[model samples]
Target: MQPIRVLLADDHPLFRSGLKNVLQADPAFNIIGEASRGDEALLLARGCKPDLVIMDVSMPVMDGIECTRQLKEHDPSIKVLMLSTYSDDAYWQESMEAGASGYVLKRAVDTELIIAIRAVMEGERYIYPTLLGGFHKPGGKAAADELQEEVLSPREQEVLLLIALGHTQQEIAEQLAVSIKTVDSYKTRIREKLNLTKRSDMVRYALKHNIISDKTV
Candidate 1:
């Protein structure tokens, strides 16, 4: 399959360079252009017509949300996945309202950016798991937090997250620096704690709770 064409838009040259490096490291992406301002991004998008854009929220001339709105108006098929330092609900809402296909936090980008990109390119709406809990208050964040402390121990959560990421028990053992039998024990406890019977069910639970969508995954 052809790599996904991308355009990087950020005000900082160093940050833009970092973005370029990350995407380049992944063979699934092809860098076509770079921009330092939202207006410049819009202009470049019109010219290159990339498959997706990794957009920074704050930019000169125009902000990412406005650029996203304009970009969607100009071509709804062009996907925009927001990359921002801001984690506020207002920004998230605004970006979504402006037609951004996904919103990813900058702090988590090194690990979560590719996951967010894969989701947006495949037509799935995504949010950085760090921000997911805030919106679904009373249930989302609270339940996940409760699970971390009360239900699943931190190491077990680590094991569960790896499982959700499609890692085998042996791989998890190597990564976690433990024996395969120990990894098996952790996995068994995680499944039993969640009352899950199948690996698929665990994956679904991990996804629904935003476990697989964050930094590690």
Candidate 2:
């Protein structure tokens, strides 16, 4: 079987090196290339054509979210699994909107990262388990169900979710197969409909309404 060809994208040399070592320890993965910025990651992704891209969300020039958008835009088939310290609901939402297959906090290094990478490669979505459960109640599944049916079109919901996940306009556009202008339009619509002002407001809406529960996607 061919190994899972993987590209590592991050601005921090030490962290990237450590992750490389960890992944390489398992022969199923191949560290094919590395990039320190979003633009560079995009270039290398195109050149390397890896099966997966493992990236850190915070970086110079273009962050992980933007890079995921660009790389996915260039080739939607290439899976992206975000590796970041951000446990924010927005970051989780944005990663999904940006078409990331999974979001694993950097703190969950070995176990969670491995699971996320594998799940995404197999066409599944993964989010850290604790974050997944934080938006839910023990018994009342009704609110969760209602939140699921609320009237955002899948694309609109996709945008909202990514906004919740902490992605920027450029990043959302890249992930959603739309233009930046279109992303702005969606943002306007979302803000108006939700009567929200700040990005934190969106995150609160998602959590409060259970738009993103312990649900994987």
Candidate 3:
């Protein structure tokens, strides 16, 4: 199988070097090129046509969000995984709107970054679990206000909570003492009942309904 071609984009040289080193150690990834600015990244991307671009949110010339927008516009097939220090929901929302396939925080990069990259490469969107906490304000009424009247079964609620807490289908099955196929069925039912098609949307719903507390996970 061909290695996943990747382009690194970050203004900081040291950080870029560190990321390149880490990615290089993984045989699945190939460092096709590196860019120190968003504009440079755009130019390099056009030339290298990498399968993925690991980009910093903040950069000179143009920000990662704008660069991602332009890159997607130029070639919709290119995947972008945003690496950022920011945990703000606004930044997360903006990155998603700008066509990011995944968002991983700098703090959790060592542990979660590779998982996020693989998830996106496999055609699944990846959002850092820590950032999901921002969807609900502490002691605020936003979550209560947004809560839906539709009720879920006990098993479905348990599955939803686990999913929102970042459990994989296999893990959830193991935890709940159910089969993987059963977990998938529960997820499908949850999505249909809530009218949610994206994992992020289900996460938000879980928060709003107090199914999963930010502090708990």
**By lDDT, who's the top model here?**
3
Better of 1 and 2 by lDDT: 1
Which pairs clash in the backbone of model 2?
A: 90-164, 90-165, 90-166, 91-165, 91-166, 93-161, 93-162, 93-165, 94-162, 94-165
Stretches off by above 4 angstroms in model 2 are: 136-217
Clashes of each: 0, 10, 0
Residue-level lDDT of model 3, residues 1-217, one tens digit each, is 9999999999999999999999999898999999999999999999999999999999999999999999999999999999999999899789988999888899878876775786678666767755654565554654423432223545667889998888999999899876787688668656655667887888887887788877866
Return the TM-score for candidate 1, rounded to 2 decimals.
0.66
Provide the lDDT at 38 for model 2: 87
How do all models score by TM-score?
0.66, 0.64, 0.66
Worst lDDT 10-window in candidate 3 = 142-151
From the highest lDDT down, the ranking of the candidates is 3, 1, 2
Provide the global lDDT of candidate 3 against the true structure: 0.82
Error of 3 at 105 (Å): 0.6
Q: Lowest-lDDT window of 10 residues in candidate 2?
A: 144-153
lDDT of 1 by residue, 36-104 (tens): 999999999999999999999999999999999999999999999998999998998799899998888
Compared with the true structure, what per-residue lDDT tens digits does model 2 show for residues 67-102?
898888889999998888888778878888898887
Candidates in order have lDDT scores of: 0.81, 0.77, 0.82
